[model samples]
Target: MKTFACALAALAIVASAPAAFAEDRSSARKAQDNGTRQIPVCRKNLGTVAIIEPDNQWWREFNLGSPEAILRVFVQQSRCFTLVNRGRSLQNSAMERALAEQGELQGGSNIGKGQIKAADYFLQPDIVSTNNNSGGGGIGGVLGGVGGLFGHGVGAIAGGLNIKKGEANVTLSIVNSRTTVEEALTEGYARKSDVSFGAGGGGFFGGTFGGVGGGGYQNTQIGQIIVLAYLDAYTKLVSQLGGLPENASAAAPPAK
Candidate 1:
């Protein structure tokens, strides 16, 4: 009877374990879906917009493709505005005209000069990142001390457990092309934290993992923050342009 009771209890636990795991999985899926859902923000198109590279030197030095990529993707996906290539329009038009003039030689029809659509607004993106250190008194220090016992030569293995934090600020602005007046400004901020772990030192067998490591433009702590900030700014821009009732028809300035 005692053996039978134990078996029954074990079976009950096994059955309940699956249920608990399924509940946890369901919760995680729900959270993930919520985070990925797109918020509908733009209702009407805001006319043609020209994107300009960020003026910040930091952005240039970072060598990350301009935040224009983010804005372009967001605007295109939202159908908020018709994008225009201000820089290439003129050159493309001239080339087209030249091709038309030589159409006979190339056995092609003479195409008339293409009409260039003037941009109604220009968009600019700027980003700034800064590092934040929270001291070395946490589990990192404990781990480092433990690693030290293994030998100072391999101390980096434990040092890699150190925490790193960073913050990013992103700003997007819309300016009227005709009036050169700022129409809308949106800002987004993001904070990111991660553990520092890397392999370096000595020969093939002498490598140690420890110390602060930096990530590439889009993969590091700052990069993650930049991406988050852009998402936030884009969300706000869409909300202002289309989500709110009062701002539904107020997205663009009146034409002079």
Candidate 2:
């Protein structure tokens, strides 16, 4: 009976091996092809919205593009708001209208004012802070200690593959366009301990999220961390607004 029980256990391990291998393969494919595959989606639109970038150019210091671009995609994917063009495309539109007024545009070109749609809400995305290397005790120290037992070469390679932790704080706010009153606010944070440098450095998404939130957010570890943080904030924002009663907005606390 003991022998039969051992046989059953061995068979269970063998049966699970292929399932584990298949899961690993699927995870690798998802990492390479679609890092944002799990982006939240909505069934209906809540309102027409425009993303407003802060006056400060902080994203530039991080090698990132306008935060509006990132928020634009999130809004579109979530289907929570109808996005409007308030960026450079609006300028181009104004230029086209100028040409129409000058008769430079072909006949029947109906470029004019009052055709633009009104925004019902404004979405503001902000990055509170980011730490690319956060945590106590360095990989170098661990490698040095291991080197005392292993050898100098092993320690050198380990040091070259040093991993660091990264974290970011982000926020998303929704405001009523007519009243200019803040309707809701959500904060998000993300931390990663798998960020590595030197020869062992490589991001998971590669080019998956590129051409949308700029190259940095899609390609670099710190940028990815920030994106994750923003995603968290956006998700929370949606959850906060999704199940609220219609009169919820009317119940805002009186200003102190």
Candidate 3:
């Protein structure tokens, strides 16, 4: 019976070898491909850190930033100092997960505790967020068909029948460890369809939202440049305060 159990154990090890090898290979590929991922360096040296997750249900799908824009991920203490992580969140999450599954985060946490390190942050940017528009009207087909009613019901019906869609803006915020250290508000406008950033610049969409108090998220028009540019300005504010810690492996030319 002892000999049989030993044989079974050996068989199990052999059976698991290929699966383990494949997992390791998968992790290695991820580590390589995700190397260029990063977040912005926080401008203010705060003791606490905060992160804002993108809400796809409202905001359009954004690939971080455009090719021209740059992203940097780092750590910092609120109202204190900022530190660039040797590993950005995207890449580190990969490494961290692998460690966690293998019980390595336990050791990391030990070292991380009381380590004078700040919290983590992510920054996604799109440099060339522009829009342009050409004006025209599409009343030809309807106008021709309405030739008979154009003199009568057309005027009254058209006045109240033109349907308009409203736009919404989203702002994401976070409070860490019972204290509000950081907040990131990403205000973006949504259209019925995807729009060219350059073409839609300087345009506004107005409509009503259905909610109580006759007060819903209204007057929602955020310019592409103004929204993204606000990030740049905020980042600078954190940096000048010397809130982030230094990261030796930090990339100078963020991934294109």
Better of 1 and 2 by TM-score: 2
Q: What digit string (tens of lDDT, one per residue) describes model 1 on residues 16-105?
A: 123455466654343332333332224456677888875333443333445665566556655667888766666786787777776733
- Runs off by more than 4 Å, candidate 2: 1-26, 32-34, 134-165, 194-204, 213-215, 243-256
- What Cα-based lDDT does every candidate model obtain? 0.48, 0.59, 0.29
Model 3: weakest 10-residue lDDT segment is 1-10
For model 3, the local distance difference test gives 0.29
- lDDT, residue 222, model 2: 70
CA error at residue 44 for candidate 3, angstroms: 6.8
Task: Give the TM-score (vs. native) of candidate 2.
Answer: 0.67
Off by over 4 Å in 3: 1-44, 57-176, 180-228, 232-256
Question: Taking the tens digit of each residue's C-alpha lDDT, what string does model 3 give over 154-193?
Answer: 4453343223322222222323333334434332333323
TM-score of each: 0.55, 0.67, 0.27
Error of 2 at 150 (Å): 49
